[model samples]
Target chain A: MNKRTVLWTAIVLALLALLVLGCVFFGLFEKSVVAKDVDQPLSPEQMKTLAVRGAYVAVAADCYACHTAKGGAPWAGGLPFTTPFGTIYATNISPDKEHGIGNWTRAEFHRAVRDGVGKGDTHLYPAMPYASYRLMTAEDVDAVYAYLMSRPPMKVANKPNDLNFPFNIRRVLTFWNLVNLPADMPPLDAARLEIWNRGRYVVDALGHCGECHTPRNIMQGMKASEYLKGAVLEGVVAPDITKDGLARMGFDPVLLPAFMKSGISAQGAMTNQMFEVVHFSTQYMTGEDLAALSAYLFDLDKLPDKPASPTQPKPVAVAPELATAARGNYLALCSGCHGIEGQGIPHVVVPLSTNASLRLASARNLIHTVLNGIPGQHFPGLERMQPMPGFKDQLDDRQVADLANWLRAEWGGETPSAKAEDVAAIRRDE
Target chain B: MTIALKKLSLTVNGKAVDPVDVPDTMMMQDFLYEYLNLTGARMGCGQGICHACTVIVENDDGTLAEMRTCITGAHWFEGRKVRTIEGHAKRDASGAITQLSPVQQAFIEHFSFQCGYCTPGFVTGATVLLDELKRQPVARADLERAISEALDKHICRCTGYVRYYEAVRDVILNTPGLIKA
Candidate 1:
């Protein structure tokens, strides 16, 4: 209670208060990124072409898949994305003046997409995939803007996002982005072919194939060590598309372009979300672009190929009921294209007998392929395969189980069979 | 810059509702689920390949035809008599099921559906096939082909074609007038 001690305590408290206030003031006063508008009036033809090119860029980005909700207006948002933090609804990018990006300037839109900075210095959560979009070329961004601006505006409002505690703090995203965004992306090798370089840019940068296919660390950042080896997405495995993985799956490098275009290969078909990606994004890509993508993918480091097929099963006679059902089902459902002896019409229908899907250790892929018929994507310069219709409704659980088992027994060398309960479980999980 | 909204009116599942304003681009699938609250027609593929959003439309020729609602627009269905999966089962005023239609009953008996995403489409398609067959009965020899042709376009993801076919066959054979002995 002495005067000297009391005076000293008061002075210390004042200094501490000033220090805290100074930090807050400095942080709050930090300047935001300035919008750099490149807007210019374009001739009608230029506008049209720019918009058209932008449409392609948007497709390559697969923006519609996340931006649009199931049965909701395209680009009007409302797609709920679930994260460890919470659900974040996509923002409406429609041209509506009030609710969408209609009022946004080119600079504002660009910054929002590339830098994850929204209007008025607001930080957009990473769920927007700005990390991938950040790699988009300026021309691509301009084209996308042109395309979006040309669309008929929808007046739908953006849904508010729901996130948990500290994660909800939008400012916290800056730190997360700083820590996670890949910092060492190498410059494209000038020695590579132009087409190959283009493919690399699209696949590794804009397309962000690793975002889904590569495993994530505990911090939710993509595991760079794993690369695109394979990862679980929404419980279903997004299989390795690496050269080694492809070779093991019996994927011929020559047929990769075709596979990318239509989502079908000698092995089997892409189902579920991969189907959506092919339908919405890759299928629409130009032939040259697809070739480039395939080239880039094929160039990846691969594991040494084994002399013998690991999944190939020893020839064995299947149960009579299963064999009979498979034969009958084949006649009714698959014979038109796959043929009587499971010899698929060359260059048309993919063969079932030697298909890799039937020989996987886990019957999940087989079940998925059988349940969800392989629909072909249209590609220029390729004979479009007729889409395989799903027999999920027409074939009961027992029939599917039998047919699947028969397929493995008949064609897949030394493959295990699937049970009815397995079929039921796959169906239920879906 | 808004897309024009049109007034759409259709007789759905035996009820004729007053015209309601709907977007010109609104798919018939959205019309049934969003506006009419008929969620039976689940959307599988947004495209027409899956046939999971199929509904029965009574043709002017007095034949029942299945339509893919996901690809078709709500405006396309204006003035049409559309029967959804909800219409197949007889319901009291409160919408409690009073009776299951022949196809519904057969489905339950044969365990024809798994996940049941495509059941509505199948039921509607089968109902139409049955109605058409009743108009002109198929001989026993041709029964299998007739069923195949009728239901072949439909896609079932659960790969339940065998049971669905068996159930539909059961209905055709057991029904008094569907098949010629």
Candidate 2:
């Protein structure tokens, strides 16, 4: 009786081990991402059509902005992305046989983009925004691949990432995927309008706006609840694009795409890092798709209550000495381009009264922008904003602090608390 | 709309002008043309993109900076010293031009200005470059680049940049101690 019982127990343990190994191999019955057919060599006409479609898809996905380094060949990939951990340089994706994805099979490429897994099952860092890209259809991603592969092959080597310890470990990213990547794109809300559903997909899958706009959790994964609520990057806040956030910035659904296409409006000019977005992605998007994006941002994110107008901050009283000095300084320095009343000149300067930079809780962006003047941007059309001269050379830290204090207190309803030391710290680039 | 007014006083052409109330928003270019009757600093692009309206502001550090008067209010120069194009030449007691400055002479000899509208900014910019060179000389190889950078912000509709640039180059080559060995 004892021998039979031991043999049965051994048999059960063997079956359990096999089941575990099978699950590991099959990834829990998940379909093989690359098993489907790769397109055969296309005819001249087919290649032309595919390439054109792929170019559009690439623009929609914003592949050019992140992949290409400044002044580097398009898609040659040396752009460095700074994170809390360290700087992660983009990989060369050109069809260069030695240094790029020329050797990768369609399956490998699809799996890398769709699942954030590189060749040999290596986990890729979230810097690639695969969590969002996974929502993209295989056809769209493959179209981008085809277009990128057709581009001139650049032998540019991918720079090694300068990430800090623990983050340098690639295996750590698997946990990031587990927590961040949704199991499946949430089932389409049938109850919503068709355009609304399309807009949701446009924003989440193609745009991936949340990657930068959403605040990251402790793990550095985007906090889904705060989707597009805005987060600060490179010193400036990527202002909230949530329904109410957009409203406060004076953008309704209809005006959203217009602002995007034009890059300048009464609200603010998109000539900052946002210029890069409009330059590559949204500018080329179809009007319908842009409308879809706006629809999703403004309507899908509607608040349950308090759709009231963004309450203006009551002007806080500044110290008489500081107020007088700052007002005079503003008249002499800033009033020329930005109107005497902060009304701003059209076709040249954005109105300071409605600017999002002045209304932020921290004056980091305001200080940075004032210290480092924004270069006048030229859009695709006859659109341009005249450059605002930085007064850093003309004014000292005390003066900048005072100006910031005045801008905040007068316009932002914030108290005058910007100290000379704060401006000095930011000026020192701390 | 009634314009705000501010009392402005500044040293123009090395003379301390009497304090006078001006429209708070009056640009320095307008102040030069309207208040002082010194109209040599022409306003090319009132938005300040073109440097034809540049005026020299002597900083506290003794470094001369070319500030655009088209976008800078007259009040900006309060308690500060400034020089317009008229300040460059030696004037007689009768207010007649007696001696042209080296930069002005170089421009005339090179025939740098056909319309003569942009000549003032060129003079101001070249003077600023000369002032900068006097303080800290540039390497001989860097002299051309320095000159190019100094006048790069200006525009000439007549397209006479080559002659003007060459004239500035001749001045740098002819001047002493401005070029490092």
Q: What is the interface RMSD of each candidate, in Å?
A: 14.1, 1.1
**lDDT, candidate 2, B1-181, per-residue tens:** 9987778998998899999999987888899999999889998878788788888998888999898898888888999999889898999999899999999999999989899888899999999999899888999899889988889888888855999999998988889978887
Q: Which runs in model 1 stand beyond 4 Å of their true positions?
A: A1-49, A82-86, A162-168, A300-340, A344-350, A354-356, A359-362, A369-430, B1-181
Candidate 2 lDDT over A1-430, as tens digits, reads 6999999999999999988656644445433334356534445565456777899988988988988999987788899988889999988888888888888766677778878887777767888988888888767876877787788889898899999998897866655666677654677888887667878878888888988889989898889888899997776678788888877566667667777777876667885678999998888888878878887888853323323344465788998999888887887778778887788887888888767677666787788878887888887588788877777887899999999999888877777777899888888876
Predicted structure 2, TM vs. truth: 0.87
Error of 1 at A304 (Å): 20
Error in Å for residue A18 of model 1: 18
lDDT of 1 by residue, A74-142 (tens): 899998988889999999998889999888877777778777777766788887777666766767877
Q: For every model shown, what is its TM-score relative to the native structure? A: 0.56, 0.87
The candidate 1 chain A region of ten consecutive residues with least summed lDDT is A301-310
Q: Candidate 2 — which residues are off by over 4 angstroms? A: A1-52, A83-86, A150-152, A155-169, A300-320, A408-417
- DockQ of each candidate's interface versus the true one? 0.02, 0.55
